[model samples]
Target: MDKEQQIAPSAGQKGEEQHAIDVGTGEHGDGGGGIAGDAAEASENERLALVEEPGKKKSTRVAALDAFRGLTIVLMILVDDAGGAYERMDHSPWNGCTLADFVMPFFLFIVGIAIAFALKRVPKLGATMKKITIRTLKMLFWGLLLQGGYSHAPDDLSYGVDMKKIRWCGILQRIALVYFVVALIEAFTTKVRPTTVRSGPYAIFHAYRWQWLGGFIAFVIYMVTTFSLYVPDWSYVYHIDGDVNDGKQFTIQCGVRGHLDPACNAVGHVDRMVWGINHLYMQPVWIRSKDCTFSSPRTGPLRTDAPSWCLGPFEPEGLLSSISSILSGTIGIHYGHVLIHFKTHKERLKHWLLMGFSLLVLGILLHFTNAIPINKQLYSFSYVCFTAGAAGVVLSAFYILIDVWGFRTPFLFLEWIGMNAMLVFVLAAQAIFPAFVNGWYYDSPGNTLVSWIQKHVFINVWHSQRLGTLLYVIFGEIVFWGVVSGILHKLGIYWKL
Candidate 1:
């Protein structure tokens, strides 16, 4: 992928297709009774993203959807770049929830919701499958190129990775896999028309009940394999560039079943067996935990008494976790169905609140009882419930504020960021934007504009390393990208697979 990637190819198609869509007239006022459309009318290539052009009365995009998506993108950028500075905002080392842990589920949830709108209209099976396949392949390719241990980016300036070391799964890769699965289910289920007598208040559920069943099946598979699969002792070699002791072998003692710790877990074991150790993410989030690092929650040298598995690699977006995460997308799909069936704001919010509350309560029950601790690394059932519930509540709130009351001014930047999510994600969160900036340095590679601004502007002004890094990420990174994304949105430039 380029520093700046492809614009949505369906822009013209979106314009052409808007003629057929009956856009809700409540663009600025209290949302009126919506149409229970047969399905969404979005073009297949840009199915996951539906953006309404400014002042385009017939545009199919919902302001709340864009704003919700934008918010996740901003949080994604914030959490990713702000790691190791503050413990609260950082991803939990293990078995806990933090601000950063919400991004993955939120994105997946948003995708689920988008899938509903994208396939809102009855789609031609051949064309829809073609788009889905192309998009999935593109997402996988980009995921591999951006991550996959190939791109050290501006930090190392290397562009080569040993085939043995290329990671097979990551954030986008997981999204691609889940999107493929969920989109297919939603596509087929679009034929199941809702009926007043059969569904009543549960029409949305009735239409997409297959998705829920699939989710339950996935949950059962995850639970059984997580508890029953035996994990044997695993070993890894460690090396630090410039350190005297670079090559050291470490063996982790497992030889047991149903492990949830970072070292000996079924999730990690399945990933190791399938993808191979070198194909797994080398530096896991757990390395910063108190068990491994000398400075807990901060990336640094290892503790003197670190566990043997501390040196081992773990893939957070491994197969089991990815399967568990499918539930998140399925929940989003349910919300999408609500949008389709419920035309009035009152009905929509009512269903959303009840469902969100139920999920939240069940998640809390599971967590407090130790049935399943909230673990993002494992993508535990409790994590899925809690985060997906939170996502629903937050989205409903956005619908009220942006869709109902028309509070779009304050969140305009977020809207822009959300509208061009794939673009902003690539440019900001993926280090491509920083690398592009770093490409223009004053003499030494370290003397880039980004380094100067962070140090002299944010860091120097704050007068503390921790505070400075935080400020730079918020202002230097987030704010700057917001403006850039806003500009791109204005230019009618957006990204798609």
Candidate 2:
């Protein structure tokens, strides 16, 4: 009695017992509704006590996810804002590697990770379906708007549009298409149910299965179209039927061929018809059967020039390649979700290391087999595997630092601008900031004020076009990031759409 009575008199004991019993409990003993009430009361009393006995203040900073997102947006801004910085901070050589190449894939993976959290908040069935539809439509409209309306450029949608140089599609267009498809998977597939009082069926929709299937199917279709569709083949149920060119091969070439090809009975005719036009103008950046660019040189009979091939059969957003691009984003989301759910450092590291090795090995295998050549413009399956795999490794590293190590860094500068990444990317792509820089305030000459200044004053700057272009683009990027950061700071604006 003496020992128990003496122990019960401790100050912490009094606070703990006072607050503990009144709090409600779930099966796990985690506090419930009553705990929230108790916490509120405790907070109020603590605040009053603090006021009575003033103490030092503590800092309130953003979370690790916020900082990570901030850093991502900064890199995205830098890469997308590049107007003509193709030499310096641009995507890598077709079959090579570069820093800029990882930016888009990183964005996609982050989107996936983000969706894991977002989908949890959305209600099931009716409301969720509606949300998915609305969000998908909005994404589509936003993508189109970002792609810009009909362009005055030669290949841009007019009746007289040039088949060779059409600006038929772009980044946002690809993003929207992928987001819509991936959204459907996230909404319907990855769902959790409370199976029992103690445990529940943690069913992940296995959306990656669908993603892989679609990617492979698209690759197969593309390969068929590239090799067999264009060539004469007749050992199966499907036949070229009647060869009839309806001017479609050339006209629909720039638009939605992925959806159109299988439906149209006149694919062979259309392909052959466009074969001439695409060869003369569109230039195929890649052909299906060719082992290498050298193996099937343009000088060969009926072969198209590499430069022209670069333009035709595929735009960066060609419907076929678009399939792979969307898959890349979807795959990215998969990696992001895995990082969020995985508990241990060793588990994440093991996963990432295995994935890295797999990608590197697969890339090497493809390089030799000439199966799905690792080309960026085409966004080949192997390229997606290699790049996305590499991105997984990097993302795992980020997850470790932000979620496990609990370290924070200078992110206010980036977070201020990154929250609205899509909006910023579209604006920066249009050179809105660069245009402002070229205005009266900094008006001098040479595209940007920075350039003008560099030319006039910093005359001894580097001679490389890549170097000059890099600095020029970076100048615009800094100015853009700065302007947006200030506006966000003043208004306290952070957005998701």
Candidate 3:
């Protein structure tokens, strides 16, 4: 695997080829109409109308898409670097909903949508399967690495690092896993046509079919696992719960570890083992499994919180649920891709409004199904469906107004950030800053700038700590993007993942 794989590919040949098919018309929009030929012509016309300079238009790229991506990234940075300010932030109690809760799922959903565009490109260019494979693996490895890797802590912060107790999985790991699975399906579905001027053995491949099939299979599997598999196991438990603890804590957090795995419950039993006993660390929800809430390291005789048992790979967006996430992304990609091919303004607007409302309905419906649960933490299936639908609506609006209607002036800043999302996110959130730099650049000078404004510039700047922190982070994000816009203007690295 290599670094290249760590990043998802850009919307490649598919966008280009689709455009090529609809070329000629200076104003064709991909508003999901009937003919590819006519749509291409209209798209050409629309493309020409957007910019006076031929080179600058392509260089500037899709303003709407960039704006959406940028907005998502900004929110991500705000949520992640919340900076010890919880009060001002909106958070649901345990199994509840809050405004901030939507950010993660939205991010993952976007990643899936991006994959759709990338996969579309893989086939047309005849990109090698080997390259894709290598890239996917590399990303997976880095994702895991981001989770904590061999070290307990993820780089350094004010909080001390603990190597022995590092979490085994996290956001990057999830991204890697999802990307690998999606890429694999895409590769299997697409095939290389035998080229007379090239290779001898290759014929043709449906590299994309597998992704479609796999997506269906994954959904079915999630249903089976959540409904049939876990339900039965839970049902088998004696009615003792009916008379025992009345606490909502009836919801167990460990599976297979309490009674099923004696060693996990008795931590002392494995003291001599080399990697320590991972039984307590293997939570069912964290990985692909037919169980849930099965590990409790504290009850395992350790009688200590230090080497606390793993939280059971318990993810809001575990393997079983990611199916919905992928679906959401696929919808966005397809909708965006198809819309860009429309020729007539009226037709484009009609499709955009219709699809937008349809998706909004689907999202609202999915939100009610507590079965899949609307949880951003697990990237729950229902969450994906709902969020994706909403994202589509948003994308459609952007497509119609900015791309089709040429009303793109208001979102230029967001588009700038969107063009370089990954870099912006990593640089803003994960990149470490020394204490001195934080004091000099952020606290001291930042306060001066803030004071120059109308609002209070100190700790009391906002009514709540969390609000102040959020505002501060947002300010940081804007500054980062400003620097990024300048660099991009100079170096032309607009979309380097």
Candidate 4:
């Protein structure tokens, strides 16, 4: 990674549960999703902050990677903050893919590309592992602070969460976990010196055999556990009224194996046991299912006779699903490795096209055949293939436009946002800045600067509510953050991790 260009990973947007027929955002996650943060995204920022020496700039960082990362952050902000106004920005309901469904996969894929570069030539195992561990911790800290039930942004003034109820899994947490595990595999197996493997089309595969094995292990674990494990009938305490004063207990029946229904999946079972039901993400996307709610794909009143698990919380980024997600990062590493070894541009593009198309076809086959449906919430194997493959194709476009064609002027906005991803996501994407401004009001708590601007300044001015809200999000929020990030980048103020 180039130290000077090194900045925070791009990311944001976590939709819990909001269902209004008029409000158009699709069903999404309980916790936020991450951009593909480089292992170096955090570490390299520290370097650029302190030193900008030419001698330290040993390798040229890929600008396209940064651009792609920025795109993820931008998309997250658009989907998360503006999604309510536009259904197109929303994630899928359950089984199908949508615009929002692509965000997390893109994030993870970029993180993988970064890991390859950051650990291209690890000199010392202890030192590299320590850096990876520390970065992981930092990423988790930010994720927890933003999504671990403490932040009731744009709504509640309270900022404390019960320790027992704090969410244990989320976007950055998953990124941190994937980064740590993938970096470890690369550090352990990657040769101290680069080996020129010019054997054939399978050269890179052979060279990174051990790392591939590591990915294979992760894949095997996710698959075997998902299929073979028995999910027992379990009970979780719930609040019938959503009031702290009163609560209820619900038992979800799932005394079977290989069941992938929204209720009885082994994926949810593993999460229940590992993170504990209360600690997992409480606002699962599945709450919008037809069987659970009066409104499908949107949060509304519960059905007259909702299933036992209708309101049950599940973690999309849980331990087991993450094992499936790891393959995404590893696939990205392959792309990065191609960049490292193959000198010719044609070779890199060729490899990427082959890999990307292959996975896409496989994923489609799996979904159509019902072998594994493409469910983003489940992080299913087929979903992994489709998203990762899509990521490769998207990255290829970025590489061509930004790096190959010298079209930097056009994507300058995204470039700026990508380079200062951390600051933008924290303040704008996560709604932290808006929430902070929401504290004061002339009459009531909701009548603050944030609401005033969105309502009176933007929403009211426009004839249509949906159009007004959409425009406000695009300009008031996204474009505003873009300018802020651009200014900070110009001033050499980069916030990472």
Candidate 5:
């Protein structure tokens, strides 16, 4: 489609500010479009006024970025609420990639891109650092508050709070850590040049050469540390007995040499040593399920039973692996630099595609070499390369279709969700919608609205119980949050952290 050349101007705003590839041209093809556009513009103007110093022109937003973020957020909600109904939608067991594995890396990649645009607008590096620190703390607080601090039996909800067993790290905590590290890198590494002089390819290279080098250095360090680090050998640790000595006699070995087992990996060992087993993820697959048994009516009893390797006491979003996550953010920062440096649409698209393809090829090659497996839990070099490449390509497609060719309306729903991403994420994860859904449940059968809807509506219509439950959770949450985000967008009520 020669879509690269079709750079449609964002109507009503000065044509000088390009919308980027994923952002739609701010032109309205119908009456609803005008109203929506006006509302979005008003919200953005207000946001800029709050963050920006007085008298400076409001920063132009790239709709594509918001759209991209919105899409990622939607998918996040879907997979999260899927509740392991679809095995493919769940994270890969150990050493391979899956559809569910890309979300966090994609979100981190976007954070790097946003940092590039954000820091450029601020005049003082001190102020930028302060803001970054505050946001990082906020993310950490929310992550722990919402996802950590408590563990309870699935069948019982009346247990007392267990202080000794509370988890500390979570999804948002990882994001917070990654964002803090990446922002610091940007603040120190990126050169703040005058806005008048166009940032050419050479200029960008000169400015960010160190960051590129730093990213490479980080990647090498991660590979060496992950593969060479000595970890406790727990290959023989069968079950979690009350006595710690049962699992304490194992020796340590290098992770690269067949030590990637759940209990033996360096990442899990560090976490357990630091946080204790009770403070880590409790229901790791290594813990045998209550219902699982060796015998059945049709089959004879088995000789021995043990915890599955999949359930080893390891946190995918653990501390040690997050170092490689920084590498993913570094890739995003590189993309952000390209977006800011390149003057024309063609230049940006060309560089983005080149970068995307190069990453894809490199990731695949690394995977094939078997030196670094594409493991999401470990945040392996190959995993970051592949996901970052996929993210870049997806952003490019959005740029071409939405910003370049002017296909905007179909994605307006996503834009609304993007506008209040963090706010909606917290709301969806924490109180608002979940409380509402819980309100419908009752002790007796046929009294709860959720069960009735699943049984009659989704199950009856789809003719599959699994599909019905999946749709009910995924679509139900998406639609609920979509409406909430839409109302907030219309009313200009964005809650930024």
Candidate 6:
């Protein structure tokens, strides 16, 4: 397949038909001569004709979607590099939304949208499934290699790699799983019949019955499993008392009624049992410090160093919560269908707004009614709804401003970043950039280059150490990667799995 075809499937469409306006030369195609020139001109004419056709859906690429994905990637890098500097920039303690929390959902939502556009172009299911499986495995492997497994000690910064204790799941792992699940659902449910029947405002619903039903089923399953499942209550156990050599002790318990506790919850319990505490995230918010400790009045001491909510260990991106992550991706798939299937720009925008509003209202109702609290750790139904709603609104705004109003000039940089998203992300997170920052250092102070720069430049300039450190890391990564992406884009070097 060609570069456009490869990138199109992974994110938004960027095929020949969907070419963005040439901001540089104010012309389409590479402006070559001979057979290549003739073919490019013919293709451009066909695209223009398609756009001018009344009532026919536009086949051009959605620039706004690419920009949106680019924006998500930028935010992901920023928040990930923030290193928990500000409370609002990190994932919420237990419940509610944070700037950081919104990034993953937004990325997943965009993935769903991309899936719709990508799969529809391919006629064969086998080809689509193969692509999905390969991509999923690639992401899972990288996530494990990069963010998973062993971590360095905070104090001594000692490096250790323990296969037995390596973390099993992480951000890329979740994305892979979620994408694969949603793609499977789409592969089976996507209609073979062309979307010819337009039912006014219900056009999107009528067009995607199978996708809608699949999403509904996934959502229902998520809610039922999260709220109705019975979990063990370990509130009574203060702390385990046993000799290290003997390993014999009587465990105590408070016998709490429900499973919302961190340790006893279904998600955490399953993770601990399957992966072990050593494999789970060692420092979750629920178990960070003494003040964050959980105490059961019915069990032992009033306060214990042990975390109240979590008894053993838990992972936010664990197996159970992945159900909801799939649901989130399913929602994105629906949005993707809207983008591809809908005929008119206005019709698409209207449906997007309606979907956004409906989800926001439903999420609020679910949270307020206490049916399911908006918890990111749990990937609660309410959290999915709210975040998806927010994502829709944000995407719609981008669509309007960038694609609809032809305000593409200002966001060309983002387009550059979007074009080489996975390349930049992997480089920033796993390979070259991070290694360079950590390994390349000055000798005098014996600090990493990043730390030295932050201390000397950003910290010295800003005076407030915390704010300067945070700003330097976040913006420094963005600018560095932005420049790299821009260079790659200019060279027409786009990477894909």
Question: TM-scores, in order shown?
Answer: 0.87, 0.61, 0.61, 0.86, 0.78, 0.79
Per-candidate count of clashing residue pairs (backbone under 3 Å) = 6, 8, 49, 3, 7, 8
Q: Judged by TM-score, which candidate is best? A: 1
State the displacement of the C-alpha of residue 267, model 1, in Å, after optimal TM-score superposition.
0.2
Task: For candidate 1, list the clashing residue pairs, or say none.
Answer: 34-343, 39-120, 39-121, 40-120, 40-121, 70-418
Q: In model 2, what lDDT does residue 259 have?
A: 24
Show where candidate 5 strays beyond 4 Å: 1-60, 151-161, 190-203, 234-258, 284-310, 429-432, 444-447
lDDT of 3 by residue, 174-251 (tens): 555565566555445545411111212111112233445656676666554444432111111112245332222222
Per-residue CA lDDT of candidate 6, range 1-497, in tens? Answer: 23222223323333332332221111232110111123354356435533322554444556777787778878877766664565456676676677778888887897777666445544576766766687788788878876674443122233556786688988889988887877677676655535454667775666677766766776777666655666554322223356231332223253433355454566666576677656777556554323353331111232444434434446988877877778788788778776655545676788898999888888889988987778788888888999999899988998888867778888876777776777777776444555545655567324777676778888888998768868786667777777777787777566654
- List runs of model 2 lying over 4 Å from the truth: 1-89, 148-166, 190-228, 231-313, 344-346, 410-416, 436-466, 479-483, 486-491
lDDT per residue, candidate 2, 174-235, as tens digits? Answer: 65566656655655654442211121122222324554455457566655564343322211
lDDT string for model 5 (209-311, tens) is 6666667776777666666777654432424587433464333343453355554676776676777766676544223223222432112222244334433
Query: lDDT rank, highest first?
Result: 1, 4, 6, 5, 2, 3
**Two-way TM-score contest, 4 vs 6, winner:** 4
Poorest 10 consecutive residues of model 6 by lDDT?
24-33
| Better structure of 2 and 6 per TM-score | 6
lDDT of each: 0.75, 0.45, 0.43, 0.73, 0.63, 0.64
* Alpha carbon deviation, residue 33, candidate 4 (Å): 20
What global local distance difference test value does model 6 have?
0.64
In Å, residue 201's CA in model 5 sits off its true spot by 6.0
Report each candidate's C-alpha RMSD, comma-separated, in the order given. Answer: 7.7, 12.3, 12.6, 9.2, 7.6, 8.0
* Residue 58, model 2, lDDT: 19
lDDT of 4 by residue, 1-497 (tens): 33222321210000000101000100011011212223343343323333233565322234576678778888898888766666545776578787888989888887777676556555577766766777788889999998898899866877889998989888888888887788788878856335566659897898888778888999999999999999999987775465542377888877899987888898899998998998987767777777877677766677879887876788888989988888988998888787666655566789998999999999999999999999988899999999999999988888778766668777777877777776777888788888888888778887788777878888789877888888888898878887887787777666664
Rank the candidate models, highest TM-score first: 1, 4, 6, 5, 3, 2
Off by over 4 Å in 3: 1-60, 83-91, 94-97, 119-127, 149-164, 191-211, 231-313, 340-356, 369-372, 431-457, 460-464, 494-497
lDDT of 1 by residue, 285-335 (tens): 887888988787777788888788876788989999999998998999888
